[model samples]
Target: MGIHIIKMPDIGEGIAEVELVEWHVQPGDTVVEDQVLADVMTDKATVQVPSPVDGKVQALGGKVGEVMAVGSELIRLEVDGPGNAAAGAKQKRPVERTETAAQAEDATAPAPVQERGADAHVATPGPAQVPIKGQAGQVQPAQSQPQVQPAAGAGHAAARPAGEKPLASPAVRKRAWDLGIELQYVPGTGGGGQITHNDLDSYLARGAMGSAAAGRAAGYAPRDDEQAVSVIGLRRKIAEKMQESKRRIPHFTYVEEVDVTELDALRARLNAQWGAERGKLTILPLLARAMVLALRDFPQINARYDDEAGVVTRYGAVHLGIAAQTESGLMVPVLRHAETLDLWACAAEIARLADAARAGRAAREELSGSTITLTSLGALGGVVSTPVINHPEVAIVGVNRMVERPVILGGAVVARKMMNLSSSFDHRVVDGMHAAEFIQTIRGYLECPAMLFVE
Candidate 1:
């Protein structure tokens, strides 16, 4: 019998370490070649590690949630015949020793030592070192490494007054300790309810710990009735991106009321004529078409600002991002080349993108590379919203709830369908006056629906 050591392999480009998410096998379990051994997570994606050769599992690389470096020992296995002879030969042969009472009789007698061999075992002096009985019924001493004692009050952040340790990997526990964050308050999203790095990050970002001081000053005790929800996966990604956008970009908002009475009439007529044949027409496509037309007048709004390069690139074609809320989280699916599509085509593309995003099947390309964004809350859109810019993009236009209100037209009171355009821009790149004018351009198109088809 021979032992084979399997090392962690390179999983992807620039992935030096991965967190062990799950293990499919344990010690002594027999596994075949190409069988899955564990599920590891890197770069927010989970990948399964498979065995290369058939063998009986001897030991696992590490516990779940442990971050293991690539090219390190991942698994050890016992296989038939000489397994990886080169590797096995490189292993150290244990040195053996024997003691005799006769030698002790002499005051200066030297201790008798046995020869080093493959069958020999190492020895060390310690109560923790236990003797292992070999196949020949000979007892062999095993060496044990010394354990480091932690200083007093160390890891107090993870300590609980209730005397319960949080379910987390050693690394996560150490990180929480360093940050003075109580793991009891940080929610876990891993299997068996273990805390992950993402959980720690989200907990910190929510300012749950920072609020403690203010609450105490106000004579408020910490609430024990609050439930801890783990922010992980897509939700975690959304939180990080939104936080980054808000932190890096200075946002300026402008709200304008548009009398969309004429635009609504045109959309209804088109839907009645070609809704079944092409696709159902919503206000989104009409808004998108108006924005596309308006972009021609103000091309600066349809561009990306690269803060790192200190430059802005404006595009003639509009790659519009339509924000759709799904079960997973909010996903913005891009409609490429919106400038080329007509009203009907835009509606069809929007429906297709929305369905794909909600079903979680949108391609990577469809989810990114938007020059500008348009978001709407449909029937639930309130009076106004200060929408955040989708970072790097200069502007984002939002559509609010359309309501019929009384307005005077040519000395007569008439009911008009009015909606507000709530838009936000990156103040660093766009001035307040220019941002206002851009919205007015969109307003003109919607107010005069015929102008959208002009050019």
Candidate 2:
């Protein structure tokens, strides 16, 4: 049998880097071309990396749950004879660590242990441990570990041997410091019993992670130079897109107040009867319906610029992207054909999309192809914030808090239902004047519910 090394396959997206989430087949296991070998995590989805050559699995790189860059070696195979590349026997397999480089990138990383906050000599956690093939490692849960107390709180720290090193990561050490937990007090369960994030989490959950830290390390002082931190996750993505929108698109913002008292009453009436289904009714559906109708009157917001084709693409139907606030990041899932759906249908779709986003189950298709977007911060008691336009299709609307306020009607001060509608459009295609008109168009529907019935 000739040795055939099976490098990582290009998944056709040409995108570099995928996270190694799981390994299905182990080395020495027989696999066929096209058999599923491992599952990889991309930015948008988790895809399975299949075998390209038929044979026995030879060498495998990296451990499961580690994020590996694309073009990196995933697995190697030993083929009996070269045959089909597209077809193979389906191979299902076991879980274990494969071979690796003798030296990892984080080699020499000292594990942090608290020896009365003395000199620490801990190696980097298991993720960056001795690299070897078929290494038998255990995922020792932190729960079994003793609570680690830090210098600030390690008043009774057990002395460590001069040559013995503690096991903990920099981040874990930082966390222990913050909580006054002395790592010296906490026994690690990592390979050679090292401290991991999970161990720290376990310690914290048990309320024994840390106590009073002695204080800041002696001779520690802040420097004049300040570190500028970049946002991460949802905030980072949001800031990048917002900055790009402001720089690329000439933005036009429009603000108007919608009198939603009648709509509110209708919602309350329906919710009372809906009970379980009534839980589905939110202000979002009504707002979506209003926006859909407004788009019908002012079609510019639903249009995209085709710079190369020299023709603007004005959409005949609305594909509304609902912005959901999730823990990891902001996800905007599109609801295609928003105009054709009724208010109830819109509410159901919004709930489904939001749930999918929250659960991290949002499909790639659910996130793309949005003609326009709706953002709701009303739940946070916010009012009248300008929303940056989501580019390409240049418009996004924001819903503010709903509250009762006195209004002057024909010189008569009376209470009127009030909610702010703030929308920003692309000045390139949707001019400021037209944008304001569009907001007013939505106001027209929100104020007069009869228009919805007629349309």
Candidate 3:
């Protein structure tokens, strides 16, 4: 038999490392080519790694939640000689023969019996230790050390009742110990009642909450209960981007209230007419149209600032980013060339992009290369907001909730549909007065819907 080393494969664009989420096989298990070995998660997506050759598993790459770098040895397998003949051929023939002879000679030599250590047991090679078990009973490598039964009154044993150790990998046990958490009390979610990292985290979080509650009941100032969530994957990417934007770009915020009474009437009429033929129209498409029209007049807002190059490149086409919240987190899916699409087309494209983003099927191109961004919370949107500018882009427009408010129109009290437009600009690139004027332009188109259609 010859050994085969499987290295981690590149899963996606610019992915350097991935978190090992689950393993499907363990050492000594027979596997066929294309058999799934593990599921790994990157910032962009989750992918399964499959075995490349039929072989007997020898060892795994790492434990769950561990990050494995691309091109690193992921799995070691023992295969038939013929399957790995090319790899074996690289070894010097003489050296291989010599090593084989030495091993044979040692095997034939008398077995030297040695004294066992005070705490040692008979040593024998066994199936690899399962670090953790999944719902299907599949095991992962736990630790290199062999399992040893603890003696009565020994270290760690004296503190607890004697029994089989908790169903957990060595890594999980170590983490629990470090956090001073009792394993027995932590509920396990893995197969055969195995404790996972998530279980331990949940237990600790609950304990913190309990402690805080008890303190409060005793009339004492309760300690703050803080849950530490790992800033990784998509969340990590968002954090880095937001930090970079705030650090590099000086932001200037502008807020304006637009009396959208006339625009709302126009939108209702259009949706009534085209709602059956095309997709239903929302305020977003109309707002996007207004923004596009406004961009035509003030092209500075539709530009990217290259801080390093010390120049701004403006685009005639608007690659609009619409921020949508998904189950995972916030995602901004771009609607490329928004200026070319009319209101109904804009609505259709917006629906398509939002669906793709929420379903986690958005392409990398669709998720990036936005010249400007528009954010709205619909009913949740308050009267006004100070939105953060999408990095590299000069501005972001926020749409607030539309509400009926009493206003003086031509010296008469009338109820009007009013909404606030909150916008933020890169102060370094745009002056405060210029930023206000850009918002004013957008407001004019929205208030006078016909202006949006005018060439």
Candidate 4:
């Protein structure tokens, strides 16, 4: 029985340190070659590092929320066949998961994973959060105690045992400390007949605590202004990136609204036909196809300007990025060659890319090398947004929700589907006319969806 040490590999562009996010397996659990060992966040990306060889986990690195450098020890393993820890030192590894328990868990970036199993205790939830009863976002008080079963869509909280009264809300019981009261003893009047905050205050008024020891038993209450939090993986990365993009770029933004009635109906029909076999044919794929066609008419919009050289280098092929929200932060995976693919092929490929990005199954190759990017905050509609350009790409297109509004066209009042097309381009390279032209061209393709398919 020998051990193999797994180290963090380079998963992003030009990053040295990675914040340790998660460990998918523990000691004695069988893992195949390419199985994800952990998720890590670097300056450029939040990436999943996979196992290099088939093995059993032996040891893992730091607790959740620890920052580790590239080449840092991640996991120690025991292989079934002939291999040793020292032997793994010379092996080349690519992050891939050979064994999967199910679809990968989608958490914002990976959480600092604690050990798993019968003995494994639950890690407390993040701040501004009460401990959810079982998992995320849902908090219900213990059933044994008299507590309210929340109304539909209402947040429910659980009760604490008699002696261990928490100092926070019923929601804070597991994550923080319970709001100091013997929840079990409190009689109920709320739904499902559970006790609420008033009940606890009533208990306290009726002499619940008499000693400083009782206060200590509750939870440590800090000074009002001081919010103590442990900064980890993706959150830390977001802080760093926001600072970088703001400091470096001299940015400019332009926005316009367009008629998208035809485009919307077209995608809806296509989705109805093929969504089950292929993932839903989203608005994003249609937008990508339109952007590619528009880019062809005004080539300058797709070109990058080198400030130092004072030249614009137009890319020959379109490597378009689709900004997607993931477990980590926003990731823009490239839908390479967006110009060549037909609508269905584009939809299928983008679906695969999004699934890969969400599961952390995306290879390093899938993330980089893009000429331009598109982003949509689905259902989050705000008029005219200024998006930051993904460096090296001269521009990024932002899409807002499509809404139907009344319009007087050809002297007739009628309803039409309308959506705003927002673009952020490098002023240093792209002039306002060129950028507007590009948007107008995209608007035309959207207005006439069949015209986009013709060429």
What's the true lDDT of residue 122 in model 1?
A: 24
In angstroms, what RMSD does candidate 3 have relative to the true structure?
13.3
Q: What's model 1's TM-score?
A: 0.58
Using alpha carbons, what is the TM-score of model 2? 0.61
Q: Candidate 1 residues 9-89, lDDT tens each?
A: 888668898766567877768999999998665543456789989998876766554567998777777888788644344
Q: What does candidate 2's lDDT look like per residue over 1-455, in tens digits?
A: 56565555565567677666567887679997789898676645556778777788765676664556666667667777653332343322322344322132233344333343232232322222321112122222121122232434233444344334566677777666545455555668778788777766665565552332334342351112111222433444466677876877777677788888888887777788884764658878887888888888777778876544666688988999898888756778899999888878888899999999888688777887889999987667466788876666778998888988999889999888889888888776777788888888788878876677685
TM-scores, each model vs. reference: 0.58, 0.61, 0.65, 0.63
Could you tell me the lDDT of residue 440 within candidate 4?
A: 87
- CA RMSD, predictions in order: 18.2, 9.9, 13.3, 11.1
Distance (Å) between predicted and true CA of 245, model 4? 2.4
Error of 4 at 151 (Å): 31
Candidate 3 worst ten-residue window by lDDT = 118-127
In model 3, which runs have C-alpha deviations exceeding 4 angstroms? 1-6, 11-69, 74-226
Judge candidate 3 at residue 308 and give its lDDT: 98
Give the higher-TM-score candidate: 2 or 3: 3
Clashes of each: 0, 13, 2, 22
What are the lDDT figures for the candidates, one per model?
A: 0.72, 0.66, 0.72, 0.65
